[model samples]
Target chain A: MKGYLGIDVGSVSTNLVFLDEEGRVREAIYLRTRGQPINALQEGLRQLAGRLPENTGILGVGATGSGRFLAGIIAGADVVKNEITSHAVAASTLVPGVQTILEIGGQDSKIIILRNGVVTDFAMNTVCAAGTGSFLDQQAARLNIPIEEFGQLALQSTAPVRIAGRCAVFAESDMIHKQQMGYSLPDILAGLCEALVRNYLNNVGKGKEILPPVVFQGGVAANAGMRRAFEQALGWKVYVPPHYDVMGAVGAALLAREKMAGGGSTRFRGFGVADTNFKAGGFTCENCPNLCEVVEITCEGEAVARWGDRCGRWSGSLGYQDEEIRNAV
Target chain B: MKVTFPHMGHMWICLSAMLEYLGVNVVVPPPTSKRTLTLGARHAPEFACLPLKLNLGNFMEAAEQGADTILMAGGCGPCRFGYYAQVEHAILEDLGYNYRLVVLEPPRKHIGELLSKIKYITGHNSWREVIKGIYFGYQKARMVDDLEKQAHFLRPREVQRGSTDRAFKRALQEVIAARDPQDLPKVREKVRRIMGAVAVKPRPVLRVGIVGEIFTLLEPFVNYDLERKLGYLGVETDRSIYLSEWINDHLFLGLVRGQRSRKEACRAAAPYLNHFVGGHGQETVGSAVIYARQGYDGVIQLLPFTCMPEIVAHSVLPGISNELGIPVLSITVDEQSGEAGLVTRLEAFVDLLARRKGVVVQ
Candidate 1:
């Protein structure tokens, strides 16, 4: 049996997924990024390794997310794509009629509007965190509730309090004020869910027409409370696919599968990537005013991959052997 | 010695006032014109955004008019505005212009650092005087912005057909001549009174909201006075951001990352736009939502074209328009954009908006 592997290493979370040749998900692993993407990817791969059949050979590998470039190099991926394309691809594949995608991950959030399976419009919030999963994590910690139980608490609410969802500061103060006002934990949690959904709608969903069948994915989609809140706010049912948490990875896997569907072999370095001694380093290119900070990866003192060169100058330099370098000089 | 910065709309009124308090001569760059655009376009990279090219042109023009030093703010982010100083410096150097570029790294924590830098630039040794100058400068800028807002609503009415130039010239002259912040209300009232006196003609107009990098939107030479050009085609304009917001975003709220700054913009734009669409892109979407809700015929989103944040916003705008039932035309301004082609798009967009609104164009 042959399978494809996909990894998405984000600022807030890392995900790994495996898909069979039939585009069916065989196994998926989702883990918290916790500011250590390298460790998260390693742990996730370990978990995925245990689940795979011993005889199953990994056919191809793909990586996506904000840290896709780094993760791609680390995973020795055959293909790499941005979150927009990856998410859109996954959502469209799952819900063939998916017209809009509301994907809120750990640290960032995005809204993709699709028309006839094509991404017509999209927005991403990388700088702000008010609507992302980390905000909810902080609120969960503040409330002394486990993140896993947050959705259940939200579901238990009788009356959801209205907290300021405009910003995290105001939301914090507002959450405190609600607590002082004698709101139950469940009500507060529910209110937070509503407020976050409201913030997402206003910020990322602004000006864009969100059409149905709207597919909500990303790590945040794992929270049933958020799904309910979105449904209530938008006055429509929001679909959460079975593999919501690792949709980015699944999408990347799907893309890799599609790209490498032909008899051609994948450029993936294989599972032995775990044993490889690799070091990633960066240096600023002084070639032009662009001053691109090119990051290069060296495996056993041999340069294997170079990226972040906006002008491809560093990549071009690395491709040449010592003879080419001498001749050029 | 007088220190001058490149003029961006009513920016000079505040900067000049600040410079004046330091006993420095403030030589404001001449108002943006065809020459400014020509000069900027001639020297700027073909792929560079219109604003960058225009700002570089503005600096060159300012240097030619006897300015020796330029003060600019620094940013640290994915936004192209962060790299403006470095690129502008290189462009100026390549052009053989000699000038000192004093970049004020955005205040990471307290406003005190920024105040001290302002003091340093102005040569105001006294903190008390520097504080006074800053307070007064801020007051003047707020007042100017207030007048400018009124002018946006009034410009179409007060000016005759193709007379936006005359009305703006008159209003700017009156604004420049105002003695103080207190004098602004009277100036505004005068402008309003004049607008009321002019005959209101019903014309097909497309209202465009210019949002993106602050420099590109306000600096006419960069965007080729895109707003003015759109206005020339009988389009109403609404731009939600200014230098003040940029200052506040960098100097103040930027301390917290993730959702904190995102919420800050949403709070700021709440009076105008009641919801968050996401990112600072929400600012543009919020304004467009309000514009559409308030019966604006059509919406145009203007960005530096390749600006990541705005691109994110642009991606979502189609859905926004689709949902709101508003026709939105997005124009990305890079150096390569031709004025004639942009004008034609504006013409077509206006025509479409008019057709949608059942307004007949003459």
Candidate 2:
């Protein structure tokens, strides 16, 4: 079997997807990053390798999300794209003619507007992460409800109470106040969902013309309450794609396939990279006043990649003989 | 008196040259860095824009270097910048830093006061020599702006990465070194030769207009080196404000030179924003319209977080974007902005622009 591999190493969750030659998803894996992207990426690749048949070939690899550059170097991706473009590509492919895409991931949320199957405009939440998936996770834990059951509980709400949703801190305090007022758990949960939806629409979705065939994806898309809240706010039906949680990965896989169509060899280091010992460390360069924090990644105790220096002193110091280092730089 | 001023792009070159030519002891604060921002942000009011914080940081760093006086520009408008000097001075006094702040306000009818301040800073330079120094400094600013314009044009087209930037640095150093008025033309020739040495690929490039608050537009440290980033993404950037232009418009030089005035921008913005909203807000709106009329690929609004004027402009920009059929992106920079996040947004914006132009970007 031959396919392209995509890895999206986001802040909270790392997802991997494999797409076969026909651009169909073959495997999907999601795991918690837990502040250690390297570990999560290797674990995902290992799991994916185990699930694949013997002699499976990865024709190309792509990486996306906040930790994309790190994932690209580790996975030897042929293409590295930002999450916005990746998500747009995924939504447009999965839900054809998706005019508007609302993606709420672990740490950030973004609104992508498409026209005639092309990305026309897009915006990501700026200076605030109040209404993302991580906030919901924290709220669920605070209420002593399993995160998986949070959406179901909200669905059972009879009268959803309104909560402040301007800032995450303010929202949390507002929720505490409502809880102390003896509001039912389900009602409060549903209210929190509505508040977040309002915030998302006002902030990230500001000035965006959201015509329907709207596709909602990302980790928070699994929350039925959020979906319902968005539908009610827009007064239109919102479609959550089947692989909504891993759409970034899916987009990366599709991008990898597109790149491979040019007839070139894949730069993939292979699934065997799962067994490689990868170590990452950082050091502050005091040579200048910038004091850039540089991160270096080592594979089998040899320096494989270095980045994060604004002046390029450390990033350019390493040899670029390796294709991975060349592309990463 | 050892004089220091905040950095705003290459304007310092002209300022330091003018002061040094008048035999004034000038101290240039260390190049803006994270430490400078951290020092400034630590003491600055949390809600103040990034420029004020950076200005505070500049003064502190200069104070450590034995600077006894700070040179700052002043303005009067609805913008918070009118109060920055006073606020920064009070903050420094609270921190027990002994320094005198000499602000040069716009000389509408107060030309005498402006001259007296300049005379005090220059210590004992004759009036004739002072005027000569001022003219020389203005010319130097124009030259620097010209050099920067060329760099922006060549950055995207340069065959080798970093070639244009390296050449720009060399040319700028030459401009700074050519202090004597007679040596100006020699510096100009050298700048042209140096910039010309950068081989260009001669490819069609996407043009982007940058307009917003003066500080954010002029200071790369606050805006995450936006011009360079756009250059790397193969986009040519045209900035709406330059030091020489600001000086020309405010110092009555524009009338003397018969140059294009801010009134033109105001007229262009009249369709969308009829009234002055303060700072460069009107100019930001006008520049987007100008760029759109010129058939540019996109317009990017760079504003410091909480900038009152640009915030007003930001609200009105989407309408201009939709009406003009040009993509507009508003980016706010503050202490909390992450480089990775900025890069991602920039790449996505460039991707959007490229796709709209039917150009395939890897």
Query: Which candidate comes out best when scored by DockQ?
Result: 2
The runs of at least 3 residues in candidate 2 whose Cα sits more than 4 Å from the true structure, single-residue gaps closed, are A319-329, B255-260
Q: Write the per-residue lDDT of candidate 2 for residues B296-354, one digit (tens) a residue.
A: 99999999999999999999999999998999998989999888888999889988898
lDDT of 1 by residue, B305-354 (tens): 66676776676666657667777766766655555345434544654454
Screening candidate 2 with a backbone cut-off below 3 angstroms (N, C-alpha, C), the clashing residue pairs are: none
How high a TM-score does candidate 1 get? 0.53
- Residue A82 alpha-carbon offset, candidate 1, angstroms: 1.2
Q: Write the per-residue lDDT of candidate 2 for residues A1-329, one digit (tens) a residue.
A: 99989899999999999999998988999999999999999999999999999899999999999989889888888888899989999999989988999999999999999999899999898889999989999999998999999999999999999999999999999999999999999999999999999999999998889999999999999999999999999999999999999999999989888878888898899888888999999999999888999899999999888888887677767756233433432
Candidate 1 at A237: error in angstroms?
A: 1.8
- Evaluated at residue B348, the lDDT of candidate 1 is 45
Show where candidate 1 strays beyond 4 Å. A284-292, A309-312, A320-329, B1-362
Report the lDDT of model 2 for residue B52: 91
Instruction: Give a tens-digit lDDT track for model 1, residues A182-270.
Output: 98988988998999999989887877788789899988898889999999999889999999988999988987887676557776766
TM-score for the A chain of candidate 2: 0.97
Q: Candidate 1 — number of clashing residue pairs?
A: 19
